[model samples]
Every structure is written in C-alpha cells, then in structure tokens.
Target: MASRTAIKRLTVEYKRLQTQPPPYIVAKPLESNLFEWHYILTGPPDSPYEGGEYHGRIVFPNTYPYAPPAIRMITPSGRFATDTRLCLSMSDFHPDSWNPMWSVPTILTGLLSFMLEDTQTTGSIVTTAAQKRQYS
Candidate 1:
C-alpha cells in the first residue's frame, strides 16, 4: 500500500503534468496503482534518437518525496537496456543524491538529457551512431 503522503504527492504531480506537460515527454500513473507510472519520450530533435519514441516506467517507493523512484526504459533506443533499472542520481540507485524537491518533470528531463550523452553507466548500452539512428 502506498503511504498517504506518497499518494497525495503523486496525485498533485499527475495533475501538474496534465495541465502543463513537459516537452518531449508524456507520463501517466496507472489507475490501479499510483506508485507506477508509464511514460513515452520523444527523442529530441537533431539527436541520434530523433524521431524515436521510447517507452519507460517509474516506480516510486511508498516513501516517495523522501526516497527516489526506480526508473527503467522499456524501449530499445541503443542507449539504455530495455527493462533494466537505470542508475541515476535521481533514481533509487543513488538515494544519497536524491532531493525531495525534485519532481516528476525534473526526473524525466534529467533522463532525456542523460540519454543524449554518451557517458557509460549501469544499464546503459553502447552502439554505433548508425545503430542508434536506425533505432530512432
């Protein structure tokens, strides 16, 4: 069960997302489970992933706002491994670095920025530009 604080926080975030969505990203929590949210990211223009649509999920811990959520990309973008948890400072992998002030938009924006970079990290994959373009 999700804690009251988690539910309230997620609810407000969802409303904010719907009213003023972030560019290149769309996310929605499941009706049955507020802790789980599915998102689609449109690759930024000019990037190798341009024209591609990546699917992913964010699973928040019940202690959300105080703890980071687990993030995973579900689509093959020649970047991150599909279905594997991504290691980011805003993710559960680095709880010490997470800031409760960060919201859904912040996390998704960070993910998109990181995707455009070539830095290797846990759950990240390496592929040629041609492969990435093809995936896009």
Candidate 2:
C-alpha cells in the first residue's frame, strides 16, 4: 500500500496534469482504479512519430511519486519493443536513474522524447524505423 504522502502527492500531480494539458498530450485514468492511466500523445510534427496519436498506459506503484511510474505504449509506436514493457529512465524500467523531482507532465514528455531516439541497442524497441516514417 502507498503511504499517505505518496497518495496525496500523486493525487495533486495527477489533477494538475489533467487540468492543464501540455498542448500535445492528454492523459486520463482508464478507470476509477486510479493506479492505471491511459494517454494519447501526439508526436512532434516534423519528427517521424509526427502526426501519430500514440496510446499507452502509465501504472503507478504503491510507492508512486516517491518512485517513478511505469509507462508502456499499447499501439506499438515503432519506438518501444512490441508488447514489451519499456525500459525507461523512470518507471520500474530504470529506477536507478529516475528523478523524484519529476512531475507527471515531465515524465510524459521524457518518455515520448526518449522513445523517439533510435537507441541502436538490442533490448530497445526498434520501431518500423524502416517503414517510410509514417505517422499513425
């Protein structure tokens, strides 16, 4: 179970993001569960992911806020591994590198940008990087 502090922090941060969406991103809870959220992020127009409205989920742990949340794209945005949970700087993906100072909005931006890179690493998801750069 999350401590009261974690819960309160998440509640406030979540509401803040919901009330003021960053021009390109919109996220909301998938259900009243509160632990699971669904987001639709539009990629930067000039970029390959541009014109794409990516769908994904963010799962907060019991220690959320104190610990980063896990983010995974459900639509296979061509950046992350297919159906594979992403390995992010935040989230359980790479806890060692996550910064607690990060808010929900910051995390979302980082996640989207990070995936835009061609990591050139095996474990990383190699999107249809070759499919002619089309947006979804």
Candidate 3:
C-alpha cells in the first residue's frame, strides 16, 4: 500500500513538473500507478548523448522519501546497460545518501548529470566515444 506521504508528495511533484517542467527532461506518473513514472530525457549537448532522446522509468517505493527509487534506462545508451538498474548515488543503490528534500526535478537533473559522466558501475558499460555517439 502506498503511504499517504508518498502519494501526496508524488501528486505535488507531478503538478510542479506539469506547470514548470525542467529542462532536458519531462516525466509523469503512470495513469494506473502513481509509483511508476515514465520520463523522456534529452541528451545533454556537447556529449556523446547529444541529439538523443532517451526514455526510461522510475519505480518509487511506497516508503519513498525514506527509500530511493529504482532507475532504469530503457534506451540503448552506451554509457549504461538498457533495462538494467543503474548504480547511482541518487538511485536505490545508495539509499544512505538520499535526501528527503530532493524532489523529482532534482533527481532527474542528477540523473542527467551522472549520465554525462564516464563513471563505471555494475550497470555501466564501456564503449568507445564513436560508438556512444553513433548509438545516441
């Protein structure tokens, strides 16, 4: 069952996202499930991901704000494996560092910032710049 706090927070965040959407990213909750969100991310310019529009989902826990959500990139970005959960600090992989104050916009921006980095992790992939550019 979803906590009232979780539902309320998600609702407020959804409205904020709709009214004043963030740059390079747009997201919304699934009509049937508030815990499941779909998002579109425009690849940052000057990076291998430039000119690409990546789609993915964020699965929030009922105990969200206390527990981070799972993040998966569905697109074939050479930086991370498709359909695999990313090992990011803001993701469920590192809950200890998560801040309850961080909102959906913060998470998406952080995700995009991390995507531009060349960090290696469990779900991260290693490919040549050319390959990444071509795949983007």
Candidate 4:
C-alpha cells in the first residue's frame, strides 16, 4: 500500500503537471492508481527520435521519490526494447542515486535525454539512425 505522504505528494505533482506542464511531455496518473503514471513524450528535435511520439508508463514504489520508479518504453523506438524496464539513474536501476526531490517531470525529461543517447544499457538497443527514423 502507498503511504499517505506518497499519495499526497503524487497528488500535488499531478496537479502541478496539469496546470504547468513541461515541454515535449505529457503525463498523468492512471484513474484507478496514483502510483502508476502514463506518459507521452514528443521526441526531442534534431534527434533520431524526432517526430516520434513515444508512450510509456512509470510505476512508483510505495515509498516513491525516495525509492525511484520503474519506467518502460512501450514504443518501438529502436533505441530501447519495448516494454522493458530502462536502466537509468532516475529509475529502479539506480535507487542509490535517486533524489526524493525529483519530480515526475524530471523523470520524463531524463528519459527523453537518455533516449537520444547511443550508449548501450541492459534494456537499450543499438540501431542506426535510419532504423530509428523508420521506427519513428
């Protein structure tokens, strides 16, 4: 079960996102579960993912913001395996580095940045720019 503090924090964050949304990304909690958020990222300009609209979800731990979230890209971006948990600093892969101060926007932005990188991580895929464009 999620703590009251986690629920409250997530509620505030959700409100802030709805009113003062970030660029290239839109996210919202699932109607039935505050711990699960769905997001759509407009691929950053001038990158291999440009013009792509990638969809994904984040599942926050009961302790949230303190424990980091599990993120998975559902889109076939050619840079990441669809439906696989990404290994990132702000993700479950690096709990020790997670900052409780980080917000939902931070995670989305970080994911976008990571998507543009060519470095290969456990859940990441290596593909040509052409292949990425094709997937886009």
Candidate 5:
C-alpha cells in the first residue's frame, strides 16, 4: 500500500504530466493501484528506436520521493532487457543517488536520453543499428 504522502505526490505529478506532457512520453497510474504506473515512450527521431512505441512500468515504493521507484521496459527496444529492472541513478537500484526533486517527467526524459546512447549498464543490451532498426 502507498503511504498518504506517496499518494498525494503521485496525484500531483499525474496532474502536472497531463497538463503539460513531455515529448515522446505518456504515463498514467493504474486505476486499481497508484503505486503501479504504465508508460509509453515514443522513440526520438534519428535514433535506432525511432518509430517505436515502447511500453513500460514504474512501481513506486510506499515511501516515494524519499525512495526511488523500480523501472522496467515491457516492449523490446533492443536496448534494455524486457521486463527487467533497469539500473539507473534514478531507479530503485541506486536509491543512494535518487533525488526527491526528480519527478516523473525527469525520470522518463532521462530514460529516453539513456536509450539513445550505447553506454553499457545492468539490464542493458547491445545490438547493431540495423538490428535495432528492426525492433523500431
């Protein structure tokens, strides 16, 4: 169960996201559970992931803002492993690096930027540009 603070923060974030959505990203919490949010990210132009619409989930801890959330990609983008928790500074894997000021837009924007790069990290996979294009 999410704490009252978590729920309130998430609610405000959701409203802000809807009112001023970020480019290439759309996210919404599950009707049944605010802790579980589903997101869609459209690959940026000129990238191997371009033309792709990747689906993913973010599971927020009960103590959000203070704790990071787990992020996983549901769609195959030839970048990150499907359904696996990605190791990012903003993710639960690196809670020590998480910032309470970081919001949903910030996280998703960072994810898109990372996806455009070839830097190796846990839960990340490497593939040729051609192979990545096929997935796109």
Candidate 6:
C-alpha cells in the first residue's frame, strides 16, 4: 500500500510528463504498479551518446521522496552497465548518500547530462570517434 504523499507525487509526475515531455526522457511503469518506472533517454546532441536513445528503469520505494530510488539501465546504454545495478553517488547504490532535496526533475536532468560521459567501467560503449564528429 502506498501512502497518500507517494501516490500524489506519482500522479503529479505522470501528468507533467504527459503535457511537456522531456527531450531525452520517456518513462513508464514496468506493470500496473506505478511505483516502478522504466525510461528511455537520449543523450544530448554533440555528446558521446549523441543520436542514441538509452533505456533504464527507476524503482521507487514505497517510502520514496524520503529515500532516493534505485536506478538501473535495462538496455545497454554503453555508458552504464547493462542489467547490472549501478553505483551512482545519489542512487540507492548507497542509500546513506541520498539527498532529500533532490527531486525527479533534478535526477532526470543529471541523467541526461551524465550519459555524455564515458565512465571508467567495463561493458560501457565508448562513443566512436566518428560519432563524436557529428556531435557538432
């Protein structure tokens, strides 16, 4: 059972996405359970992820807003591990590291920006030099 606040938050987020969608963010639940959201995000133009749309999922705990949700990419983004959980500074990767002030919009914005980076991890696809050329 979800608390009123959590339900309201989900509703508000859902409505906001419907009107003015994000340039690189499209999210939906894995099932009828609105708490789990799967997303597809495109990298900003001219970045390593340029012209690419990556897929991931955000699992919001029933006690969400109080605790940051867990985020993982189901599809291969080449930026993050595919299927394996990530260790983002703000993710439940380290629940104690979460910040209360952070919101969905902020997280989404960070995600859009982060994919441009080539992290020091295996299974991450380095955007080809040719791809970077068209990023202009």
Using lDDT as the measure, the top candidate is 1
TM-score of candidate 6 to 2 decimals:
0.79
Candidate with the larger TM-score of 2 and 5: 5
Residue-pair clashes per prediction, in order, are 0, 1, 0, 0, 0, 1
Q: Model 6, 120: alpha-carbon shift in Å?
A: 4.2
For model 2, the run of ten residues with the poorest summed lDDT: 120-129
Q: Tens-digit lDDT track for model 6 on 40-108?
A: 787666566666777888888887777878888776655666776666655777788888677666677
User: What's the TM for model 4?
Assistant: 0.95
| Candidates arranged by lDDT, highest first | 1, 5, 4, 3, 2, 6
> lDDT per residue, candidate 4, 77-133, as tens digits?
898899999999899999999999999988898888888888788789989999998
Worst 10 residues of 6 by lDDT: 127-136
Count clashing residue pairs in model 5: 0
- Candidate 5's displacement at residue 78, Å, is 0.4
Q: Positional deviation of 23 in candidate 1, in angstroms?
A: 0.9
The runs of at least 3 residues in candidate 2 whose Cα sits more than 4 Å from the true structure, single-residue gaps closed, are 120-123, 127-132
lDDT of candidate 1 vs native? 0.94
The predictions' CA RMSDs to the true structure, in order, are 0.8, 2.2, 1.0, 1.0, 0.8, 3.4
lDDT (Cα, tens digit) per residue for candidate 2, span 1-136: 6578777777787799878877678887666767788888887877777777888888888787667787777776667655456777776777888788887788788777776777653336555655515545
Question: Cα lDDT for residue 23, model 5?
Answer: 96
lDDT of 1 at 33: 90
Between prediction 3 and prediction 6, the one with superior TM-score is 3
Lowest lDDT block of 10, candidate 3: 114-123
Q: Which portions of model 6 miss their true places by more than 4 Å?
A: 119-136
User: How high is each candidate's TM-score?
Assistant: 0.97, 0.85, 0.95, 0.95, 0.97, 0.79
